[model samples]
Target: MPGLGVCLALAASAAAPPVFVPVERFTLAWTHSIEKVRWEEDYAVVASPTAGQPPVLQARTARVRGSGAGMEPPDDAVLRNGWYEYTPRMGSPQGLRLTRSPYTADYAWCVDGQCVPLGQWLPSDGGVTLLTPCARPPAPER
Candidate 1:
């Protein structure tokens, strides 16, 4: 990594270096362009089971406000506080790749109740922005 941060990184393109972040967990929030329903998926930085392997991103939970065709929450989702919340059964992925555009609502990385657009980290230019868990090295001793 080119920065002094941990857990996750977002790269503007395949040729670009990833922007390391000090986040252990964050929620990816967005609204469907067609249905206009809000969806949020919670994720965490998970360490690799094998030694010396880099960490990965894991889906922890999910929630959606309102439902429509193709936007229904899982069967186990519970309606709580106007949002259907549930634990996503999708297995852990190595990283998340998000494509951004002016035609659709931007994705937000929410942490501590603050949600910032992914564009803040990298401007969209019709390319994919990759978010992946990064292995932060131990701080060097002075």
Candidate 2:
């Protein structure tokens, strides 16, 4: 019985958590007007504290518009948001797809509804590019 107990402890240590921590949150801090719009597929980079753990890739869907929608806009409104979690096995090759045009610079990356930096913007292709100046590690919370 003692030997079995030891094995169980070892096995449990190797398991990953069912949910990951939400490091940071942000809202639209700034906005930029683009001359042209393009629809591209991108990935959101997330961090995990566990060592030897791979970065998480979340799917993101975004849309931009020249003007804001009036009261009770259409279901396919000009603006939309989606959140995703990271998987260790998938790595960064797979990310969310953005199916909108007129990409506006006004949209900002955020966590928990707060504005964050460009570095937080993890590319779906496994590239770490800092899109903003206020890049910081995500807090240890949901």
Candidate 3:
């Protein structure tokens, strides 16, 4: 019986598939006037809502993940959680770089990093309103 148990354990181990952990995905969104920028860990997209106008200047960052079925992040993007709050990562940058393209566009932004002087391009009227990191939606109760 002991030998039979040993054989069963070996078979189970052989049949088990290796585990592959997915990378954590993060996203940051920034808007200035009609210009909007969405940055993910791996890629960045900038769009000018009005023709001829460039994307906005001010920016904000958030931790974003998929909310519905069939929704997928870009090929370079990951899909993980944990963007609500921040703690400095010892010698690293204050916050994670949210966009792939850092400074080329005004909307490119970072989150939870050390405070910096606001750019002249950012609108003064509303200014920048940082978003509170939000909780991931609960899975539908089946």
The residue-by-residue lDDT of candidate 3 on 58-97, one tens digit each, is 2222233332233333344434553232222222221222
Where does candidate 1 stray beyond 4 Å?
A: 1-12, 137-142
Name model 3 segments beyond 4 Å from true: 1-72, 82-112, 115-142
lDDT against the true structure, each candidate: 0.77, 0.31, 0.27
Q: Can you list the residue pairs that collide in candidate 3?
A: 25-78, 25-80, 35-56
Highest-TM-score candidate: 1
Q: What TM-score number comes out for model 2?
A: 0.27
Q: Sorted on lDDT, highest at the top, how do the candidates line up? A: 1, 2, 3
TM-score per candidate, chains pooled: 0.83, 0.27, 0.19
- Runs of candidate 2 exceeding 4 Å displacement: 1-33, 36-53, 66-107, 117-142
Judge candidate 1 against the unseen true structure and give its global Cα lDDT, from 0 to 1. 0.77
lDDT of 2 by residue, 37-113 (tens): 32222335454345544444433443333333232223554443421212223333332222212343423445554
Task: Give Cα distance to truth, residue 135, candidate 1, Å.
Answer: 1.8
Error of 2 at 7 (Å): 34
Provide the lowest-lDDT 10-residue window in model 3: 1-10
lDDT, residue 32, candidate 3: 25
Question: Which 10 consecutive residues of model 1 have the lowest summed lDDT?
Answer: 1-10
